[model samples]
Target: MTTVTLPEKTPAHTGRTPGRPGRRGVQPLALNIVALAAGLGGWALLSLLGFEDLPGPAQVAARGGEMIADGTLLDDVAASLRRVFSGFALGTLLAIPVGFLMGWYGVARGLIEPYVQFFRTIPPLAVIPLAIVLLGIGETPKIFVIFLAAFLSSVVATYQGVIDVDKTLINAARVLGASDLTVFVKVVIPASAPFILVGMRIGLGSAWGTLVAAELIAAQEGLGFRMQQAQLYYDLSTIFVGLITIGLLGLAMDRLLLLAERRLTGWQERR
Candidate 1:
């Protein structure tokens, strides 16, 4: 019997995969380019339409250059970032352990939750006046504001994440001869990492906002202080610059946290 002979291998495709490198890269770049173009075009149109007071990209760029020349802008940014980092670090360190203890032990939960819940309702901004009265209008008040902002947001998330850990996995660990502390360290922490990272991101954002609010009353250097000065002088361009810088910095921080989360909890994400 004669049989038809077929080729050993199938043909190599010429087309790219749906989300492969070529197609994916082009799509996002094209979209971003279009958006940038549209935004600049709108600014130009607004200027032409007699919005003289509203600063456009070029005006903001020029203002940024002027601020860099003066050297105040960098100093302001450094001050704000330092305050935020210190407060956020301290708050998260305190909150995470307390939150874990509360979530893990019934007695701890009963003892601490009432205070946590009560304080969570109080606005961070509302406490600034009280902080100033007690701590005075110094670095203490600003740091306290950021601490409150980070603690309140982080504790809730940490508490929830610990409680939400899978009971079955914990039991499995116990059956496999793991002690409570061992299981907690190995299984519970890994299980809850994503949630913890998510909480940290939220707390970081809150700290940034609180830094601005805290600086409002204070004497000295920060992006918020710069913005307040600009407002007093009615330098709209400078105000815009301060705001834009805050947004960009916040965005960068969030992206950094996202990268950390992806790196640390990569296994969970894969599943």
Candidate 2:
């Protein structure tokens, strides 16, 4: 008998495990910090150059600090946050079901799509006058306008998401003995979740954008109201402070939605 030798087998590749992010995750955060620093540097450079009217980051920071000390900033923040949250919540709650109806049923789509499109064509700002005229110049008008902004954005996105879901998946679910409700709950909703979340994010941005105009209607205290007041005196520092505050608040809320999206859609693929 002849002696035989076998080659050694190589070990299996050990890649990064699921659910735990790798170095690529930290890279994005670092890049964001770098980009922010560069933006600030650019702003400072502009102020130093010929932009006498513009305030630098340091000046804005000092002005913001003064506002914080005066308790005005806190009140404004609270009021704006209340309106935004209330309006956004109400709009989204109503939008999801309406969007589902329009996308799922033919008759509902025919009746609803026309109005949705019509309202979408009209800017939420344009409704300010009507809102004030009808609802009165109070928190009602402000919240209503914000609700319109959020609702239009969210409903369109949701409707598109539902329509865009792969028809093959629905058919497969039905073939597998799934009922209409089960197919919608298990197949449609999960697939459409990303789109819905994206719509919500867009709606959030719309809400913030509409806020300044909404606050224009007999508003006393809000970031937007504060900015308008500062504008009369050309208080560049205070205006900058308000802008920065709104941007920061919106960024924080968007990040929260992004976190929710990632958690809910973890099974979805990423680049």
For all candidates in order, the CA lDDT equals 0.87, 0.92
Where model 1 places Cα greater than 4 Å from the true spot, the runs are: 1-37
- lDDT per residue, candidate 2, 34-109, as tens digits? 9999999999999888587688888889999999999999999999999998889989999999998988889999
Tell me how far the alpha carbon of residue 103 in candidate 1 is from the true structure, in angstroms, after superposition.
1.4
Which lDDT value does model 2 have at 86? Answer: 85
Residue 99 displacement in candidate 2 (angstroms): 0.7
lDDT minimum window of 10 residues, candidate 2:
8-17
Off by over 4 Å in 2: 1-26
lDDT of 1 at 5: 94
Best by lDDT: 2
Per-prediction TM-score to the true structure, in the order listed? 0.87, 0.90
RMSD per candidate (Å) reads 4.1, 3.8
- Model 2: residue 41 alpha-carbon error in angstroms: 1.0
